[model samples]
Target: MDRIRPWLILVGVFLLQFFLSELLAIRYYRPDFVVIFILYFGLFFGSYYGVIAGFIIGIFIDMTPLASYFGLSPMTYSITGYLAGHLQDKYIRWSPFAFHAAWLCIISFHFLVFTYVRYQLLFEVDIVQYLLRWFLTMTYTLIFLLILQFFFPIKRIQGA
Candidate 1:
């Protein structure tokens, strides 16, 4: 039960984000809450857990209406989570600037990957419009990250 508690929390977070994304219409262009959680876990827990969370969330995301391509999100999210985990290991600090920078990178990566997949696999969309939408979405995510960081801080573990 104790071991499963943490997993439940993680799952709960994912589901909350998923529902919010759907209800709030965050899928048009922006950072995914699932991706943010994946990055957060990866940064805190390490590669193995990050990969697991990413995979699970990716599956959920793929099943969502927002997902156009079947497997692209899962694969991209897994890679992003793994990389974030590795970065956390290499760089052990919790500065606000660092958090913002990391958030920007994650959001940017997701935008590019999603756009590419949509362009190549799903439909013929205008790149210029997509770019504009991506920019707006990324901006929104950055602002949201700032707000979230203040409200729910990420605790740094000792010797981590």
Candidate 2:
């Protein structure tokens, strides 16, 4: 049972993503549940599980009609998972503040990538405006993270 916590979290997150987003979403600034779980498993469970969870979660997300591009999420999420998971395990075990900061960074990076891919603006686009949008979305993600953090703060892994 202990071995399957990540998978269970993935499933719960997926169900919440599908059913709760519409209700919880505040206009265009919906929190990314995928980011939440990805960050959790990545930071707590290590990169291997993080990548696997992100890949599977991305696939499930793509199956929904809401997904703009099927392939985008899988790529972006898998990478996010890996990067988050790569953080020093010792740092995570010692400090909640570190965990919070890392969580923000991972989620912010993900939105930047997600937005850039959606726009594909490259050199021609207005950089400042795009950045502002990214900042706002990151802020939105942070707010959700703060709320979730209260309920589920990371503890040291038993055997890791």
Per model, how many backbone clashes are there?
Answer: 0, 0
User: Candidate 1 residues 1-160, lDDT tens each?
Assistant: 9768757877787677766665656557544676667777787788788788788778877887767789887887787778777756444456656755765686688767766667652334566776767677767666666677777654442133
Q: For candidate 2, what is the lDDT?
A: 0.77
lDDT agreement with native, every candidate? 0.69, 0.77
The TM-score measured for candidate 2 stands at 0.83
Give the least accurate 10-residue stretch of model 1, judged by summed lDDT. Answer: 151-160
lDDT of 2 by residue, 12-116 (tens): 989988898777766666667888788777877788878888999999999997688888888889988898888747563647677556656777789988988
Off by over 4 Å in 2: 92-100, 121-126, 155-160
Winner by lDDT: 2
| Candidate 1: regions farther than 4 A off | 89-103, 120-125, 154-160
Q: What is candidate 2's CA lDDT for residue 81?
A: 88
